[model samples]
Target chain A: MTALTDDTLPVTSRGMRDEMIVFVVMALLLASVPFTGVYPFFVMQALCFALLACAFNLLIGYGGLLSFGHAMFLGTAGYCSAHALKVWALPPELGILVGIAAAFVLSIITGYISIRRQGIYFSMITLALSQLLYFIYLQAPFTHGEDGIQGIPQGRMFGVLDLTKPTVLYYVVLVGFLAGFLLIFRIINSPFGEVLKSIRENEQRAISLGYRTDQYKFLAFVLSGTLAGFAGSLKVFVAQNASLTDVHWSMSGEVVLMTLVGGLGTIFGPVVGAFVIIAMQQYLASFGQWVTVIQGSIFVICVLTFRRGVIGEIAHYFRRSL
Target chain B: MQALYAQLLVGLINGSFYALLSLGLAVIFGMLNIINFAHGALYMMGAFVAYFLLNLGGINYWWALLLAPIIVGIFGMILERTMLQWLTGLDHLYGLLLTFGIALIVQGVFQNYFGSSGLPYAIPDQLKGGMNLGFMFLPIYRGWVVVFSLVVCLATWFLIEKTRLGAYLRAATENPTLVRAFGINVPRMITLTYGLGVGLAALAGVLSAPINQVRPLMGADLIIVVFAVVVIGGMGSIMGSIITGFALGVIEGLTKYFYPEASNTVVFVLMVLVLLVKPTGLTGRAA
Candidate 1:
């Protein structure tokens, strides 16, 4: 489960506006780092997870559903894309498509089952369903068990662009992240998004209006899963590996933490949250297992004292959605 | 023939733990409307406590079985009082998150001390050896676990369904504000109910310790499977949890018999199928 939606503080307050302004300056500052010869791979990783957080916010922030098995989308797409490249020798474009398509299909089946139960039960169902997929992938001959679908040839995009070069890969992932982020912004602003918010606010009223609320929720879950798969597909290319770690429940918790730390319902909070969490992981990678303790501490602290999250609290204080 | 009986035995054994754990979850859900994510962690702790009691305190299996649940129940009461109580009247998700955090902390501390490798919990002298029924041999500890858990399960059912205190619990679960108006101190009852639920899980842990090795990660894996059990059972009824727990365990055990490949996932696959045809669950009341 994630943070409650009703507790979001208003964005117009002074602390929030100052925070938004700071975030914009920070984003711009981070954007300029590649030119200064800072490692772009780390930056790309942060940006990809940032986009994922934004996609996840669509469901938790607007739809009021906490899915505990979101990693299925990411890892499923990763595995799909990897397998496509390995088995079919398909171009990178088709590989990404394969990943997205697989993730979409998986989400539809999982969503139908999970949406039957709302709140905590929904989370558990999604989690168990994802675990089922995990076991399938674990034993499926194609997954190669512990080795995973590794050494995947990041084939030429449209049979031309060389992906071995880090710069090209960075640009591809960056564009993908931006597309996801902007699409989420648009989704939040659309009339459909308003209906989702209404459903979140109170399902009874929406159902009373004959809105077919479950359809919206299912679609939202699929959309979130698909985009998360896109991010996962990109991740495998960046890391050049897609293992069981990607499918584990911990990855799901990581995304939840990123969204929670950034802001549950807010737009930009997830990005900030992802960056912060990933950065912590990078810096603390040397510390070994203590990272889990640190992550748990963060979960506790965010739930206890900083429920609005970094971006959401800032947005609320600033009186804007951000 | 031997394989079938063995699988049936395994299924029945798993069913006992499933019934116990899910029963606890349902009881807690009935009162506070929060899924105790830390339920697994506490279950693991029960096994660990029994282990420690044997090693450090020189307590035998019987004494630890009685004491571990009490200790774990007190821990649950403390959790209910400290963190969970604060989240009341808010959205239910927060309660889940709070418990998840608790689970993380408890599991982490144990892992730090115990490592991931499992520690063996030896069977007591009283429950040693195996009994052969010509077709199959049953280990005494396994038999005791199944029989004792069923007794606990039935006793719990009786307490909730037939007793006076359980009537208050059911009443409070129905409408806490109204129950409070009736001067039942429903808040305190809710805390105690959470404790009781947690206590039940710990009891399952004690039962499981003899058969399964006590590892910090033991409950983490088992709890997820139990969650699938809870889903298939449907949280709308208490008996549903116990019956589905056993039935699914048997199904799972049989899956292991016929096709070992699907053993790990048979329950989850069943969960999906149940959700498809009867979303409210086989025994659950319609939402």
Candidate 2:
């Protein structure tokens, strides 16, 4: 019985020490970016998306739940944060807190409705629920319909470290991304993470093992949503606006694309994927709608030929878990 | 009362399209096990194809209806043989992703050429004008659309439910390997089934061209609602999709008359309620 479980469930491939070394190297490279003269704005935007993608990966990669409406969390948090800062005249940290709270509530409601179904049905349900929110936001007065909430104040954190300074803001965003990333990493290696992985690998077996699988999945959903919301709150500082674009189905698709291109279940894959996609969008902005076509083509190529993704292929060849 | 009747009629017309589209989805899902995310794009393509035939080829409405589905159906078959078929035996999510990519490509190409604005397709000479049903004035084209879509939907239902060919299709769905053991061409049937389903979506597109106008992203948001309908009604039964589609459309129309503000969201709210009550959907068996 133990052999069956061992063979069926993925073996913890690489040593924790190896992962730690890679994490340290990654953190060092990212921390030194302000001194390297690379564009801080682009990195900041990518970091927000990377955090969002990592939060998304925690559910799909480890928990085996694919939410097609994660944009709801991201968009909800961004809108709330923008409102808090701009309209309510709250500080940056409080704005982020309000956003996180909104996302927390939204996740509970959406998760309750969506988690009842499994597989494709779950995805469709989440999508429908998000679209419902989209319509509400479009009509609701506070969202300002298509105009969105704009010109949010990038105030100081803790009454110091002015967010108006590019270098300071970049580090803050980087720190936020790292905090979210480490939290996700910790969750994945925990005993709870193993149980979540077992559920993903085989839900029936997990149930047979007497685990209340639904509660675990629900908890995972809330954690992922709240973290994604945190990324959204951070993004408001960078983008300075919360718009309908964040809530659109296409945004949800972009998150999926990022996670897939990096490595669906891999740790570093989402970060790499987010940077690659954001950079492509920035450079290929001149192509107009052709960019969409290209992104779509990338999706097709990934699903068909490059199913392992960029990081997945690298890890597979190196025979080390990234 | 007259306004209510008119809205109800409008709702039924919308219901007809929903029924046709969701019916097609159910058929495709049964055979392919993939939710065709590109269904909406192909539906939009059908309208575009009709427009092209009328403007360039000088084919009228009736002929365009017959030709568009066949042409787009052929394209869907090519997609199946080329890209989608390669994903056999993989996770269902890959199919959803691949089709989503196809949707974006098709919609993006159309957006590039046509821009984001709507192109008006005039109603054919025969479909113009209206009739007095004693209660309300009914547009002749709208009336024709309802009657024709009902006929097409039921005909599809008959084709799938009460035919020898459908039996083979159902058998294959149940056990493709066992059906293959009997020497039937199961793969060809799968392709044809996809073609048939896509053809149904194109047919709905053709029917709605005059009413909704031809637009690149017309089907984008609409497909999400249909997915909700599928989730609520379940893809297990063909008749279930038909009834649920029409029922939701009618309910939405009633909401439009009763509370205009909530009109856009009534279906989704209902979907959440249904999911809460029955996780397996109204007609779905446990998967």
* lDDT of predicted model 1: 0.85
lDDT values, one for every candidate: 0.85, 0.91
Worst 10 residues of 2 chain A by lDDT: A1-10
Candidate 1 lDDT over residue span B173-225, tens digit each: 89888988888899899989998999999999988988888988788878889
User: Estimated TM-score per prediction?
Assistant: 0.96, 0.98
Q: List the residue pairs that clash in candidate 2.
A: none
Model 2 lDDT tens row, B35-118: 999999999999999999999999999998899999999999999999988877777778898999999999999999999888
CAPRI classification of candidate 2: medium
Residue A230 of model 2 has an lDDT of: 97
In model 2, where do residues sit more than 4 Å from their true spots? A1-12
TM-score, prediction 2: 0.98
